[model samples]
Each structure stands twice: as C-alpha cells, then as structure tokens.
Target: MPAWSSEMGAAMQVQIDKIFKEAAMQENIDDDAVFQEGDGVLAHLKFSFTLSDPGLKDCPLIGCSDGFSELTGYTMEEIIGRNCRFLVDPVPQEHVENSARMVAREFCIAVKDGEMYTVPDAHREPWMPIVHRDDGIFCIQTNARKDACLFKNLFHLKKIELDEKVYIVGLQTEMPIELWDEDQPEEKRQDACRAACRACHKNMGAAEQVMAKHFWFSSPMRRQEDGNDEDDGFV
Candidate 1:
C-alpha cells in the first residue's frame, strides 16, 4: 500500500462528492426509494465529512443509510457518532511494527441510475480469514451478523471482479514509541529511537513500492543526502 498523493486525494474527493450529491438528489425525490429491500444494490453510508479529518483523534459516524442497518446488526441510533473502526478489532502493536505499517481502509461502491453509491461500513472480524473469490481476488466481509449484502449488491451492479485488495496504504496512526522506557540509559534510548525510525522508513519505502507497481504512482519516499531526515521519519 502507498500513501495517496495530494493530487490523487483531491481527485478522489471530488468524485466522492459527486456521488453523494447525486445520492442526496435521489433522496429528495423519494425518501423510501433509496434502500428498498431486495434491490441488490448495497446501501451507502453517508458521513458528514467526505474525507477523513487528520486533526480529529477519531472519525465519528454521523449518518448512515437504511441499508447500513440491514447489513449491520445495529441500527442508525446505535451506530451514529461511533467510530466505524470499532467494527473490526484493533491491530496489535507487534503486528503493526513487523508489517509494512500501513492501514488500508476499504470502501465498496455501486452505480445505479447513473449515480454512484457506496457502503458505509465494510470490515471483517479480526478472527476470520480473508476470503478468496473464484477470480483469485481476496475479500473480507464486514463483521456484521448478516450476510455480505453490500458485496453481493456491488457484484450485481457490475459484473466485473472487485479489487478489495487495492488499499490507500499509509503510515500507521500510532507508533510504538513507548517500547522504550525513560529509566533506560540515555545511549540505549537513543539507539532504540534510531532503530524505530529506520524501521518506519523501511516500511514507508515498501508501501511506496507497492503503490508504484500496482497503481503506477511515483514513489513519495525521497532519500535525503544529509541523513538528518531520519529524526523526522517516525511514522
């Protein structure tokens, strides 16, 4: 996974806004028309914000579609204002440290009547294995009690294979800085910090490689000749 470039992120946001605006227009036509039962179009969940707010500590779920309730066990009342990330268990600190340290958020969408709709919540339980489709693509259903209605809906809308594996990979939100204790010797603490910084840089580079290979995006990780950039590399 690789971090999205500023231009790419802005482009995506524009597209997403168009989708939501169309959905809103449709809603105005008929309140009961959006998520009819058995429509086979997975309902979309709409939040107040189109993009994630980096400054906020947590992203709250302000509103969701009726289809969201149908897929998840909880209704809008239970889910609204809660962090959507809660659907899946937290990633362990050790796992984050050992892996590429990138978080890949998944979103499923469908186009109906020339309007694009997206599912609000799509996450698999931490315990379940990633499911593979006949086409060799991997998928993880939302940890909801109901079946994968959203996925099924998306498949129905577009007969093409879905690439759930495509991820907006970026640095892990929280780093394991606490792994070093203050009581440790100054030299030992400094060494540990250096090691952690190196690991972060390595993970970031790996993520960039994946993005470049798969999406044809240029690498965002630039090597510094001075080597002082290591101090600012703790992601």
Candidate 2:
C-alpha cells in the first residue's frame, strides 16, 4: 500500500485522538448507566419534570437529552422549564379500564412532578397499563415475561409537531421469543429482560442500516420524519 503524506498522517492522528477523547468523555457521563456498556446498543434517553401542587399548573421540564429532541421535534430550549403536560393528550374515558383509573388515582396521591414513578411488580399478569396520574393517560404497559417487558418499555412517549399541529408519537418494539420458562428466578428473569432490551435495540440498528440503503435510496425525498421510525411496530 502507498504511504500517507506527513500532512495527511498528522491529520489522521488528530482525528484518532479526537475519537478517543470523545469515548473517554462518554465513559464519564453518568446518565443512563443501564445502557452505557457501549457494545453498540442504542442509548435510551429519559426525561423528568416537576409538577405543581393542588392545581398542578406549573409542570416544568427539568431534564432531557438530544435523543429526546430528535424524538419530539422540540429543542431543549423550547421544552425545558415548560410543562411536560403539553406533550400529554387527554385519553378517552371509554378506553381506560376502571381498575387502571383507580390505580392511577392512587399512584398520583400527593405525588410531585419530579419524582419518578416505580413500575409496579405485576409478575402474574400478562399485560398491565400504567396511567399517568394527572392526565389519566396510559403512559406505560408492563408484561410478566422478560422479552415482553423489554418490548413494552423500550420506546416511550414522545410528541411530534408537524404542520403546526401536535401529534402523539407511536413506535412499537418487537422481538421473537426464543424460550419461555416459567420457573426462572426473579434476578435471572431481570437479566433476561435486559438482554432482550439490548437485542431489540440492536435489531433496530440493523434495520436502519438496511433502510438507509434500499428504502432511502429508492425514495431519496422521503426521509424518516422522527425517532419513532426506530421502532419495529410491535407494541
């Protein structure tokens, strides 16, 4: 092979140094420790906000990431210090089960906005939908099986603004089941769940690679409008 010139060699060395520096910086970042292994799994982003008391009027966005901006079409400047409820749309009462509504009311009792909600331990049930306390809207759904749990929790709520109209984003994550054993320990079950989550993220990355070539090449004008395209539509 031909040797690189001194100038080109120096530039290449600088680029390598920059890559290492960035990798080190990312290692130091504390957010989303669960997905920080950096084995090619997509990093999951989480947002938290503070809700007001009694009237619950001033629900300000406290934290977010660039991933959220890509998902929601709103920059941190536009979203931070603003009520997250702006992204929440009211759910129809007819669709919500009475039991879920009751659970939501109980979950919201004296709950502050910035506080994180713990997903309940419902290992016996196949599916359980968790509703947001303030809006009574379905925010998350959980499943008893490990793979099912990953599929349900992976892609979360995001609101997209298109043509000056706000629309709730939809994305589903699907993973094929390899085995179903009912006798696994709780810790073992959780490990399986994390593996499943990683698998789904990897699968999404693979699909994007294919779409970037075949689908996008076929229609150069039609780009993925938002982050929801990352999901496989299983949910």
Judging by lDDT against the true structure, name the best candidate. Answer: 2
Candidates in order: C-alpha RMSD to true structure: 22.6, 17.9
Off by over 4 Å in 2: 1-58, 90-109, 113-235
Q: For model 1, give the 10-residue run with minimal summed lDDT.
A: 152-161
Candidate 1 lDDT tens digits, 1-235: 2343434433333333343445444443232332332441113332111122222245444433333444454655666556555444343333232111111221221111222323222432222223222111112212322332221110001111113222122221111233234774554433433332222233333333322333442333222122333321112
Q: Cα lDDT of all candidates, in order?
A: 0.30, 0.33
lDDT of 1 at 159: 12
TM-score per model over all chains: 0.24, 0.27
- Residue-wise C-alpha lDDT for candidate 2, range 1-235, written one tens digit per residue: 1222333323323332333334435554343343454542333222211111222345344334333343344555665555443433233334233443333333343233333344355421222233343222233322222111221222323222223322222222222222234664554434434543333332333223322332233333234534344433211
Kindly give the number of clashing pairs for every candidate: 0, 1
lDDT score of residue 94 within candidate 1: 36
Tell me how many residue pairs clash in candidate 1. Answer: 0
Model 1 spans > 4 angstroms off: 1-55, 90-102, 105-142, 146-235
